[model samples]
Target: MQLKLAGLEDIEDVLTLHRKYQIDTILEEDKKDGFVTTNFTREQLTKLIQEEQGLFIARHEEAVMAYVMAASWQYWSVWPIFARMIADLPKLTFAGHTLSTENSYQYGPVCVDKAYRGSGLLEAIFEFAREKMSHRYPVLVTFINQINTRSYRAHTQKLGLVVLAEFEFNNNHYLELAYDTSKSLSLHQSTHGQH
Candidate 1:
């Protein structure tokens, strides 16, 4: 598998993978395999890619196998839920580092194709993204649905992400996770290079 930051030319391929694992397309029993909470639009993705905000993809034989997105708090306008998430960021911290809109970026909506789910590609993609993003921001933050055990385990266990806080929004419970970029990378080195 090959991993790299996505360019505008790769937008369509990314969109295809996004749709394949989108929540609406997966069945309840199949959800354990994987699912995406958000469906980013072409326009939004175009802007993100152009600005180099964060959209990393892993590919095999030219097919997108997995994707991870990282964006600044300014993205809150694109998704209302993020506005609520941003409102609570000031109350959290990691390794003595406070998470503020200016110093941290939003990370999430990661989607890995089911075929590569257990092969460590997800961790590799995140590691690559963190390396690229950490240069610009010191913290990486994300939220996972309380019931998405598959994602929760991968983020907290496999990736070693720390839970900073949790809150309810629109009736759904979510766990806020933070990673002190510099420290998180060093601590997860063993697992980061797997596969």
Candidate 2:
């Protein structure tokens, strides 16, 4: 198995993995069941694939076995820091961070193909992503709905990410965890050659 940054050709497999996780997250409720459903189309993936900001794929024998995607952006008051990141990962750095927007790296849509489940692929993906992201951005953050205990457990096991704040949306609260590159991932070694 090998880990690589995602590209246009890998969108389909990524999408399949994403949809499965999304359904798994919503299986217990009725309207709430299919409520989180997304009709995100192929065109959308095509567009995201072109951005190259935050996405990755783990391939086994040329097929995508797991994937993760996030958007790298800076919020208001972070212009200077954003500039530093741009200079660091110049080729893949984005000039898109805005002062009025919340500066953050949103990670998610990570899924490992079922057949390969429980094999520690998720931790592998996150460790790889954290090293790469920490090198590029100053911080990394992901939000897990308060009720999504399964995901919470998974993240803690892998990244040791824990609650930093809480957010209310649609009358539901989500646990927000923040990762300071220097603090959270300084000692982690890559599971692959990339690091």
Candidate 3:
């Protein structure tokens, strides 16, 4: 698979993969299979792309296979859930590093094609994103639905993200996870053995 930061031209393929794995599109029986919590619009994506905000995609055979999105605090005004998350950021920390709106970026709603779910492609894509974004931000923060064990394991066990806080929103429980970018790069290298 080819991994790189997404461009405006990639918006359509990114939306395709985003829609395919979204929670609402999957049946209850398939919930255990995987789920994406957010659905981004073309306009929102276009803005992200135009501003050079983070959106990394992995493609194989010229088709999008997965994507990971990272956004700044400004996006909170566009998504209320993010606004809620922003309200709690002041209380969170990881590895002696405190998270602040200026130093951290919201990470997630990452989705991978079901066919490549366990193929180690997710980690590769995340590492690619970290390599690109870590220079601009020291911390990467994200929240995951408590029930999405697949994603929880991937974030905690595979990516070395730590759960720093937990809260409920609209009746759904979520765990806020943080990654110290500098340390994470070392962890990724050691755990994945140079990828």
Candidate 4:
């Protein structure tokens, strides 16, 4: 597999993988496994690539097997939930720093195709994204729906993200997670040359 920043050409394939596990359209049997709550569009993805350089992907056999989105609070502020998260940033702290828009960025809605779910792909791509974003941000933050036990476990267990807080939004409960970008997950080398 190849891990890299996604280009415009990757939008469709990324969306294809996204729809399979998106909250709105995911198969019922898949919900217990995990699902992405955010919905993105081609134009938004274009901005993510051109503006923030935050769309990361892993490709296997030329197909997008997993994708992770990270970007500044400004880019994400368009969404109400993210706006709320931004407002709460001053109240959150991680790795000896008071989290702020300047020192932190929103990360996630990571969607990994089921075929590649447990093959070390999640950790590899996650580190790939964290490594890339570390240049600009010292902290990475994300949220997982409380109902998404699979995602919460994968992130907290395999990735070691800290549960900083929990909040309710739009009647849904979520766990807020954060990590120090300077810390390495050490899985990048494991995915080498799989492309």
> Estimated TM-score per prediction?
0.92, 0.68, 0.92, 0.94
Q: For model 4, what is the error of residue 121's alpha carbon versus the real structure, in angstroms, after optimal superposition?
A: 0.2
Q: Pick by TM-score: which candidate is best?
A: 4
Worst 10 residues of 4 by lDDT: 186-195
Q: Give, for candidate 1, the lowest lDDT window spanning 10 residues.
A: 186-195
Tell me the tens digit of each residue's lDDT in model 1 across 82-150: 998888878887767777888888998899988788887887898889888889899899999888888
Model 4 TM-score on a 0 to 1 scale: 0.94
Alpha carbon deviation, residue 193, candidate 2 (Å): 24
Number of backbone-clashing residue pairs for each candidate, in the order shown: 0, 3, 0, 2
Candidate 2: list runs displaced more than 4 Å. Answer: 24-39, 74-103, 183-195
**Model 1 clashing-pair count:** 0
| RMSD versus native structure for model 2 | 8.8
User: How accurate locally, in lDDT, is each candidate?
Assistant: 0.83, 0.58, 0.83, 0.92
Better model by lDDT, 1 or 4? Answer: 4
The residue-level lDDT of candidate 3 at 89 comes to 78
RMSD of candidate 4 to true structure, Å: 3.9
lDDT of 4 by residue, 94-152 (tens): 99999999999999989899988888999989989999999999999999999999999
- Write model 3 residue lDDT over 42-152, tens digit each, in one string: 988988777856889998876899999887878644677888988887887766666678889888878888889789898888888887878888898999999898899
Which ten residues in a row are the worst by lDDT in model 2? 92-101
